[model samples]
Target: MFSLKAALAVPFAKFIVKKEQKWINNPLETQERVFQDLINDAASTAFGVDHEFASIKSHADYVKRVPIRDYEDLKPYVDRVVAGESDVLWKGKPLYFAKTSGTTSGAKYIPLTKESMPTHVAAARNAILSYIHETGNAKFVSGKMIFLQGSPVLTEQNGIQLGRLSGIVAHFVPKYLQKNRMPSWETNCIDDWETKVEAVVKETLPEDMTVISGIPSWVQMYFEKIQEKTGKKVGDVFKNFNLFIFGGVNYEPYRAKFESLIGRKVDSIELYPASEGFFAYQDKQNEKGMLLLLNGGIFYEFVPADEFFNENPIRLTLKDVKVGVNYVMIISTNAGLWAYNVGDTIMFTSIKPFRVIVSGRIKHFISAFGEHVIGKEVEQALKEGIEGSNFQISEFTVSPQINPESGLPFHEWFIEFENNVENVSDLATKIDAALQEQNSYYFDLIKGKVLQPLKISEVKKNGFQTYMKSVGKLGGQNKIPRLSNDRVIADKIYDLNLIK
Candidate 1:
């Protein structure tokens, strides 16, 4: 019925793909132009003037002039902007504040201005458009594509609009495609996640759902609800469901469960986006990494993951980065963030094309007793350990138990499963053995008895979901931290006493 939509988009999508391919071939040149443009645009802002933007001639000068900052360092300026200050960070007041989950450093309000909206909104749109162009799969756009996003109902803080990042992006969906979007505004605005999912299920079930997009976890929930309501797998209900677009969390561990829920495998694409920016996306199939958005409105820097916590670490630009080294990402963007650490770590897989895989977050590493382990290691271990296991993990988090009262320093895994395990001890041992093989530091700790072997606690059904609800992080784009450095969140999970 809507073949015209496919025909019209094909030419434009091809143009974008061709342009991106050429830009990616010359990443350094593209990045330099982006950085220069950002500096020129924000030269009059408070931060720009304070850092003497006029004197910044190169990436080195910019780095030296503006010290790397995290959200805490920029909070004062952001607060002033929230209080109606103009030109504090950008040329004018922000159009909205993207409220991120407080899971790590507490809830943060990232400013979003008109100049920045195109980068965030258009990049996401291009992910799909690029997929259609590269794979010649535009028919999906002819049918409904449900994006499981946060409620667009925003709050006004000191005359500035604020809401979840996903919600803000949803408001900017192109008018041409509004007819194919699902979940009415009222249905999307439901405060409770459980209620919202049910409403979304009802609204989208009777429609032609060709593409489903969101975090894998929430999409899994929506699939389960659909199966429960109709006694049929998601694919059976939506025969045209062909593409799955996901981000916000690694999909490796959840792939098995997602396939099981859908009752078959579906082509999927991954995106790397945060409240701060849209960073990368899968440009081709059967690829292990995402192509970085080099020509986007952002400048990139990398600090060696091993040296990121050091007092002074060497910084590398796009020209000097090496594939396979885990690096903490820093960026300067059109949105007024300069040399800012968004807390994510990534490793490049293809230097020529600048493709990267998200490794983990800096704060989300376990190093309580010098057994420093990152999210990538833990996830890899779990995937290997569960390869042939009878049960599947729905969600999990690991933390250090350092107190002697807890019986020696050790790593504790609180896991929620899709099905109960036959032998908990065996599962725990397999996971520990797998982790030890991947991380020598952890192996040494266990060998030297500085830390005991890892321990596991099986969670009751819906335990993690209930905990997320209690903390008001129940819906779209929020995810369980795979690893924590301290016992803060782990203690709460232990207190839940959902052990099976």
Candidate 2:
């Protein structure tokens, strides 16, 4: 069959693959050029003037003059931008404001400029293109791809479009690929997730779906709907399905269940896109780490994760980082965010070619007893616990129980199972053991009696969904947090537990 979409995508995809390959070949040169270009592009902007960008010729000067900041610190400038102010953060007003959760901090409006939009588009396109070039898999582009995305309905805030990043990206789908997209405009516009997913199942059931992409949990929900509707696995419904591209949440804990839902092994790709920028994506099939974007309209910085709470912490640029150190990712982007902390933590797995694996979130951790357990460790522990178990987990979260009057302080895990565990306590023990192996501080806390053993609270079916719905965060791009330092989110989940 002649594939017009494939034909149209191939040339540009190939060009991007080649370009990225060349760019990664000389890391230092690419970093230098990207930094210089970013500085030059924003030299005339208000932030540029205030920061004295004209005199900054070296990385040292740039680092010295500009301070590392989080979204709260950048709020004044973003406030000015939101008030229809031009040239406050970027050269001009942003085309859109990516509305996303600030987690415990509240909501945020991240600017998306003309210069920054291409970074997301190109990086996303090249991720697929790079995979195709490596595996000679043109079938994904040859057929329709069911991108489970948010509705591209915009609400104007100061004459600026404000919506989810996925929605914003959906509107910019290439004309050539639009024919190969799914759910229809009307179906996608449905605001409710349940209604939208059901409609998607009906719309996509009869179509050719070779590739499916979304957050892992939402994709799982879609697969469940397909199985419920057709009484067949996803692989049977879409036999041509060969690619599963996922992001937003760590895929490790859900990997087994995702594989079972599809009913067969498929090629998978992971991305690390935030509202601020498209930072990294899996570029190699055999590799364990994602290739960090160097030339994509963004200049990178890293602060040691452990030292981030300090009044002034050691900030390292791309040229100064070493592999294996956990760092809170910071970026200065063309989108008008300068030295902004995006909140996620990552550690470089390889430095020669610059590959990273997301470690955890800065705020999402259990350190009440100074155990300092993070999302990555918790995720790994969960994966280890479920290795040979018959049960599959749907969703889970952990929080510290620090009240001394309530017997002893312990970490509580609220888990919703896809299948019932025959020995829930045994699994919990294994998970606790696995966590101890990963973090010595956690083990010491347990040994010193500073914290009690990990306790499991098996939640009822759809417990997390119910919780999310109750909180009005049930839909697009909203993820169940893996770890909470306090009992704020976990206590609500505990209240929703019917199984306990």
Candidate 3:
């Protein structure tokens, strides 16, 4: 079922990749120079805001200008840009505004300008370069590089859409380059995997796929499927791959499953990206730590965790950031977001030239499977489910996972629903179903056989709070995986069933 046209693209793609890498990795500090120039431009705009008429520029003055702005303060500015005004923020028309599911609040709109395209490409494509470095192979078999991210078209009326940054670029790249992209601009990913995309993943010989990019979890799921279909372990598929790259977060939760598939450690490129913008990515194949910030297109201002999100924040230069402490990353990019708070947290790995590890989100996530599921969704659903039922409880935690037997991924709600809610299991299922009936992607996942239904784990009274208390973050971060669609974990949750 593989397209002959797609097959023919492989050789040309391989050649183009080499040329692209050359353009992407000019001189070592070349990006930094581009970054400095971009910063000077943003600062010039920020500084000129003074004289009701207009003003002048100072390299030091830009740095010393007003403190970095956060999400709340920049809302009005973003609104102005959306309305297409000649506001102080964006100088030109919106090329495209990449969106994020704004992990903390609603949705985020990160604008892109013609000026910033190369930086995005460099940050994203380096994963390919890093793969060649780590795996020591770049030769290919066949098939186009498949990317799993958000649809190029926006769906939700108002919400920060979560997706890989590469998804947006697939549509905008020139038609000559279009042959390298997957079919259709209307395709859905993440919440709803495209059938053709899934089929390509299923049908292609692992050896044939030289490069693969997707969320870590979905790739793991695909790896498992490839094994089931071919009766061959992951090593068979990986041996053929010149590179394996994943975006989203740390691959630790998936480490065991992925390793099991490959039967050995397959080198991978871990990318750091946001739906709002393609941020930083690994610069070297051997580098297994924090990504080098794409400082070329974005002016960065780090706010110390202790003081960063405060009423007033003190900014840190690329040179001033300290190691071993958490900091909120703020970026003023060519994408028209100035001092925009993306709401993710990080700790420095090295302080000299600047390297940091992704700690976790500033928002709430149990992070059990590292799924990045919002705790509020589960909590809100359970609250709504127990509406009339007399389920009494001080607190609760809901973990979602795949039901291996049914072959459908569903939520196995681990709940501490308040007292006297008879039939918590049945009520939990009802609430889960209701949520999906309202939320289309979850519904599509069910219809398309991507996810199973929902089940409940009835916790014995004090268990929920006790679990949270044991983790040192009683009132804070530590909870459990709100979303896990993995078989290994889901099976355990199902077998335990909270009754045991």
Candidate 4:
């Protein structure tokens, strides 16, 4: 029965792929249409009236009316929506609020309107369908699929349901996939991440698990637990488990560790999803970047990352964006996020069909001594430095060590290694060289003796996990920032004595 159903989905998947090619081929047109639709739909809402959306005709006109806003800047309007005010941001009350923890603000409620909610589900399904179309492998669809996400339990706020984005998405799993989904509802409701993983392990032990999906860090924990329970690799236990779907964090740094955990290389799909909107997904098996979703009810604006903080930075449309430049992604979505900065920095790998890789967050960087180093640069440096070596990194983070007790100040890297490196000092030197090669500012800083070379602090086994647990953010969409301007996380790691 499962095989027959899987066979039936192939044709449907191919059809969807063919249909998506239209928008992919006409990116600018599709974005313009989405932008116009958003404006027209919410013309009667309070935000539209305040911004004079009814009079807005073009991207230029819209931009002139709506200034770019972060969460804090837009909170006033969002508060009205949360206070049971209809048509405050969108046309009506949001179907759900994706509750996310903010750095400065407590909890952020990102509204998911009726018109916007389906895009999240559709994009995820399309990512899978695109994979099937490209690889012609649908047999995995017949087996059990597990999404390691938050509990489906949601609380009500005003007239809207509120939960973590993953939890809210849990309630929208397609009926066809309901039976194939693993970790029964009761098991999924467990709040403790460790306990939930154990429950998931016991339930999925006897099943033919095929697709495993979650954030890479949390998924690594799951794989570790599975190995602990079975005394075998994940690939050995589940022969058919071939596809790994991951989002939230970059998977390149974790690739070597994951391959070791699974005991084999498996196909993986990288998704660019957030509480605001589903932005992109890996559409090709061998592609370097995910296909940016132009027709997915989002109007994108790009501001060059370097100029992002400047007074009135240039906001370029899709057609004006250039390849290889890191830009802060701004979006006006059907969900009523007007000129909103999603906070992600993306570098366009391709212009035709529009593909992008999330480079890093705009706010997450290390520039203490005027050597601005972004997340992508650091990840690339580590990957290049550790290339072909037996050293496997479990997790790592970088921070600026402004006031060193002994030597001139330098960048500090806290890394949890899965295996021991023969010489940590040599590895650190290689990584520093890689970073210097990529970033000229960093290179000049080192040459001018403004900053010393980067240093690595070995984190004991599961040290990052211990630090996260200490702060009450062990799992469930929580991830460690790759770079920090301050030593907040570094100090905490020291406090817990997780450093070697």
Clashes of each: 0, 0, 11, 0
Compose the digit string of candidate 4's lDDT tens values, residues 24-133.
Answer: 99888888899889999999999999999999999889879999999999999999998999998898899999999987889999999999899999999999999999
Give lDDT tens digits, candidate 1, residues 289-312. 998998778899999989987887
> Could you give candidate 2's per-residue lDDT for residues 170-260 as a string of tens digits?
8888887888888798998899999999999999999889999998888999999999988898998898999999898888878888888
- Least lDDT summed over 10 consecutive residues: which range in candidate 2? 1-10
Please name the candidate that would achieve the greatest TM-score relative to the true structure.
Answer: 4
What C-alpha lDDT do the candidate models reach, one value each? 0.87, 0.87, 0.54, 0.94
Model 4 CA deviation exceeding 4 Å by range: none
Better of 1 and 3 by TM-score: 1
TM-score of each: 0.96, 0.96, 0.60, 0.99
TM-score of 1: 0.96
**Which runs in model 3 stand beyond 4 Å of their true positions?**
1-36, 39-65, 103-106, 130-136, 141-144, 153-164, 172-191, 194-207, 237-239, 365-500
Q: Give the C-alpha lDDT of model 1.
A: 0.87
In the range 13-119, model 3's lDDT, one tens digit per residue, is 46644654553454235445654565555543432353211222432454455456566667776666555554356455555566544434576565666676666
Error of 1 at 413 (Å): 1.0
Sort by lDDT, top down from the best: 4, 2, 1, 3
